[model samples]
Structures are given as structure tokens and as C-alpha cells.
Target: MKPFDFVQPTTTDAALAALAEHSPNVRILCGGTDYVVELKHGEQSPGVVVDISRLEDLKSIELTDAGLRIGAGVTHTEIMAHPLIAEHAPAMIEAAHTVGAVQTRNLGTLGGNLVTCVPSMDSGPVLLALDAQVTILGPKGSRQMDLSEFFVGVRKTALEPDELLLDVIIPTENLGKPAGFIKFGLRKGQALALVNAASAFRVEDGKFKDVRIALGAVAPVVMRASKAEAVLEGQAVSQDLIDEAAKIAVGEAKPIDDFRASKEYRNSLIEVGTRRTLQAALEAANG
Candidate 1:
């Protein structure tokens, strides 16, 4: 790894100050599960590395008036074990479990996973389905945006050079919303997703309400399958309707032909994944 000036900030304010002082020449380091690998591979050469792993402010998981506030520094393992997460967003735990293995889960932060902005990231689909939002802190102060808006493209986000992701919030309305996540990978473990999907909705008077379907690994960035969602929204919940929506979801994605899988194969997975996740969500809503 290239040598760089390292500053371990004990507070979020200190971390933001370091980022502002260094500006575009600096990078933030939290769980380092992804950034450290980038450094070792010579993909990143920042003049200054501000380590925010020690900042207690970014390690909390609390329920605020706005919603469930999950600190950016919270690890996959922590998310899987947290009562609030399990109680409010259980599908997130399922997604967190699929991220690499125990070792990677131990060190990979939720913010790091999202900040990496990989189209196949395990964390993105579930969060998107639940309508999560991200908070960012910079020299100018803090700002919040929908998770869909936070993602810009493959390996890119809306975060600025001197900004730090603060936390992710699943709005109060989405808390405990019936949701399901499914990932199709080349292997059972430590494999990147070829197609991943999540579905969330509420059942009211035997009809689907506020339905959301999100797909990943089949586009430049994780995206909602809006047409598919439109198919089910406000409709009577039934297996036939879910099957129709899943088929529509396949048409909405733009999967690429890659050595790992063909575009055709990905399209098929998208359909199956959407169907299964929706079924799972339906079951949750029923109970």
C-alpha cells in the first residue's frame, strides 16, 4: 500500500474537519473491508486517510422520531444481531448474512457496503425495498437523501469529496413493513450476486398496498422495478398477480452479458427472484 498520512479521529466533528482540511486529497476509512483492499491494490492513493472507526457517534443503532437510525459504522454482524433491526427490518438481517462470510461480516460496515456502491452489493436491495434514506455530513453540514438518490452509478455515490455518510434510516412508516430479500450467486458462499431482488408491501383488505420491488446486479446501479411494482400496487394479492409482476420485472432490468452469467440467464433469475421475494413478503404480510 502507498504510504499516506493517517488521522484517527475520535469524534465525527474531528473527522469532518480532517476531511475539509484535506479536501479532495483525503479519504475516509471506517471498516476498511473494502477501502483497505482498494489501497492494497493501488486503486486508491489518498494524501490523507481519516480513520473514523473509533468514533462512537457513528457506531450506534437507535430508534429516533424519524425512524430506526443505524450508524454508518455498524457492522454486518451487528446488524444481524441487533434487536431493533430484527424487530423492525428483519429482511436486512437476511441480506447482511449473505455478505461474504463470518470474517467479512465482522469487519464490513453497512455504510461501507453502500458507499462502495457496487451494483451487486447485498445490502442495497433490501434497503431500497424498505425505502431507506442516508444522512451525509460535510463541511457545509449534514444533509439527508433517499437511498435511491444516494446511489449514482457503479462504485459511485452522491457523497462529496469532503462528506461522510452519517447513518441510514428506515422511515417510521416502513418499520416492520413486510419485506423479503433474495440473492442469486454463482456459489453458496463468498460469491458475488448475479441477480438479487427484494420485495416489500402491506396487505390491506386483501389488496397490496405500497408495494416496492428492487433489483440489483442487473443494472448500473441497484434500481427499483417500477413497472413490476405498478403491476401489483393496489391489486388484490394473489399468486397469479405476483407471477405477472415478476415477469414484468424481467423486462425492466438491463443485465449485461458477462463471463459469470449470460444476460438471458440473469433475466430468468430476475423473474424467479422477484416471484420468490414477493411470495415471501406476502407470507409475512399475511402473518
Candidate 2:
């Protein structure tokens, strides 16, 4: 790696200023789990590295009128340990636990995971299923957008180089909503997800309501299975309906043949994963 300048701004304003000053030439480093590896391997070579790892402004998990506000700098381990998250968003805990491993989770920030924008990122599906929104800080000020819109494509996001993600909010209406996340990998530890899926909904009067399904790794970006969601939503839950929805989800994905797994294998995983996550969410709702 080439020699570069390193700055660790102390305040949110300072961070924003640093970004505005050297965005295209600078790289933000919080939990270096991803960026550090890139720097070492020459995948990224920024002229300036802005370290925000210790910035206290971006580390909190609290409730708000809007919903739960999860600071971008909040680590995966913090998510897994936070009592509020455990009570209201348990599926998020399950997802966070699946990230890299104990050490990586200890060091990785939720913002870093999302900013990395890898399709198979473990933190994404559960949040997407919960209809989360992201707040971003830029030179012009702050802006909010649905987490769905935050993602652009593989290793990309809607975040401009001059902007820094501030926090993630799970909308109040979806608080404590029954949701489940599942990731399929070749082995139990540190394996990239072959296909990951999440589902959420309410069981009202014995019928599905507001069903949501999000999938990852099968496409360029993490995506929702709206077609599959349409199949069982507002309908009475049944094995037949679940099976059909799973099949629809399979059709919705565009997995590609790769060394880790074949497109055919991923397609099968999508069906099974979507079905199981939906079933798990339904069971949670019922209980």
C-alpha cells in the first residue's frame, strides 16, 4: 500500500468536514474488518484514511418515537448484547451472530457492514425485513432514505463519497414485529453466505398481514421477493401456500454459477431458505 495521511476526527461535524475536504481521496475506517483487508491486499488505495472508530457520537442503540435508533458505529457484539434489541429485534441478534466470528463481530461496526454493501452481508436481511431507514450526514446536512434505497449494487451504496452514514432506524410500526433470518454457508464458521433470507409479518385473525421477504447473495444487491410475498400475504397460513411462496421466491432470484456454489444449488437454497424463514417468523408471530 502507498503511504497516506491518517486523521481521526473527534466530532460528527469534524468528521463531516474531513469527508467534505477529502472524500474521493479519503476512505473512512471504523471497524477495519473490511477496509483494512482491502488496504493490505491492494483492493483499495485511498490517499487519506479517516478513522472514526472511537467517535462516541455514532455509538448508541436507543428507542425513539420513530422506532429503535441504531448508531452506525454500534458493533455487532453490541447489537447481540443490547437488551432493547434482544427484546424488540431478536432476529437482528441472530443475524449479527452469523457475521464473520466472535472477534470480527467484536470489531466490526454495523455501518461498516452496510457500507461494505456486499450482497451476502449478514446484517442486511433482518434490517431490510424490518423496513429500516438510514440517516446520512453530508456537507449539505442530513438526509434519510429507506435501507432498500441505500443499496446500489455489489460493493456499492447510495452513499456519496462525501457522505457518512449516521444511523439506522427500524420504523416504530415494525417494532417487535415477528421476523426471522437464515444464512446458508458451506461450513459453520467464517464462511460467506451462499444464500441468506429473511421474512417478517403479522398474523391477524389467522391470516397473514404485511408479509415481507428479503434475500441476499442471489442477486447484485440484497432484494425483496415481492412476487413471493404476494403469494401468501393476506392468506391463511398453510403448508401448500408456504411451498408455493418458496417456489416463487426461487423464480425471483437471479443466482449465478460460481466456484462456491452453482446457480442451481443457490436457487434451491433460496426456496428452502425463504420457506423456512417465513415459517419461523410465522411461528414467532403465533407464539
Candidate 3:
């Protein structure tokens, strides 16, 4: 690892100040699961490392007027255990569980995972499915944006060098929205996703409404299957519809040929994963 000064800030303001003072030359560290590895591999050589892991404000999970605010510093283990999250967005728990094995989950922050902007990141699909909003704090106060807008590309985000992700909010309208998450991997234990999917919607008058399907590991950013979602919205749920939509979803993704899996295999997984997750979501809605 490269020699770097470390500053552990107790408050969000202090953290922002640290970022403002040293950013571009500095890197923020939360769980260190990803950043630490980047540091050790000499992938990132920040002059200063701002550790916000202990910033209490960024670690709370609670309801607010805006919606359910999940602080960025919250850990995967915390997400799995939180009663509100369990009750309102259970699919998120399933997603968090697939992030890594127990040890890494214990140390990984939700913000870190999303901020890393990896296409295969497990935390992304569920949040995107829920229409989650992200809060970013910078030198000029804070701003909120759609979670989709937060991601730019592989290892890239809309966040500025001096801005820090504060929290993510699942909108009030989507609270307890029926959703399902699925991840396909080679061995499942600490494996990067071959293809992962999430489906969410409202069941109204025996028809699907506000249907949303999101996919990861098959695009530059975790992306929504708008074509598939369009097929389901305002339509009656059925096996045929799900199958057709899943096929449409395959067309939405541009999966890459890689060492872990082939593009063709990923496309197939996308179809199956999309169908299954959509079915699971429909079941969740029915019950």
C-alpha cells in the first residue's frame, strides 16, 4: 500500500471539509473492502484517506418525510437485520446477502458498494428497482438525485471529487413495493455475478402497474429493462407475459464476453433471471 495520511472524521461536516480540502488528491474510505484493496494493489494512490466509517450520521436507517432514508455508512449486515428494511424492502436483504461472504459483508458499507459503481454490484439492482434516490453532500450543501443518475459507468459515478454520498432513500410510494432480486454466479460464495436482476411493481385491479425491471453485470451500469417493463405495465400477469418480457429484457442488455462467463451465457441468464425475479415479485405482490 502507498503511504497516505488518514483522517477519521466524526461528523459529516468534518468529512465534507476534509474532502473539500484534499479531494482530487484524496479518496474517501468507508468499509475499505474495495478502496483498501485498490490501495494495496496500488490501484489508487490518494494523498489523503478520509475515513467516514465512524460518522454516525451516515450510519442510521430510519423513516423520514421524504421516505425511508438508509444512511450510506450502514453495513450489509445492518441492512439484513433492520426491521424496517426487512418489512418494507425484503428483496434488498436478499440482494445484500449476495454481496460477498460473511466477513466482507460485515465490513462493507452500502454507500461504498454503490459508489464503486461496478456493474455487477449486488446492491444496485434492488435500489434501482425501487426508484431509490441518492443524497450527495459536497462543499455546496447537499443535493438529491435519482439512483440511476448516480451511476456513470464502470467504477464511475456522478459524484464530484469533493462530494460524498450521504444516504439513499426508497420513495414513500414504493414502500413495501413487491420486488424480487436474483443473482446467478458460478459458485455463489464470493462470486461476482454472471447476471443479476430485480423486478418490482404495484398490483392494481389485477394488473401490473409501475412495473420496473433492473439488471446488472450485463451493462456498463446497472440498467433498467425499460422495454420489458413496458411490456408488463398495465398488463395482466401471466406466464406467457413474463416469458415474453424476459426475452425482451435479453435484448436490452449488451453483455460482454468475459473470462467468468460468455456473452451468450449471460444473455441466457438474463432471460431466466428476469423471468424468475418477475415471477417472484408477482408472488410477493399477490401475498
Highest lDDT model number: 1
Flag the better candidate by TM-score, 1 or 2. Answer: 1
Predictions: Cα RMSD each: 0.8, 1.0, 0.8
Candidate 2, residues 239-285: lDDT per residue as tens digits? 88989999999998999898899999999999999999999998899
Model 2 segments beyond 4 Å from truth?
Answer: none
Query: Which residue pairs in candidate 3 collide?
Result: none
Model 3 misplaced regions, further than 4 Å:
none
Alpha carbon deviation, residue 126, candidate 3 (Å): 0.5
Instruction: Give the per-residue lDDT digits (tens) of candidate 1, residues 259-287.
Output: 99999999999999999999999999988
Candidate 2 contains a number of clashing pairs equal to 0
Clashes of each: 0, 0, 0
Q: For each candidate, what TM-score against the reference?
A: 0.99, 0.98, 0.99
1 versus 2: better lDDT goes to: 1
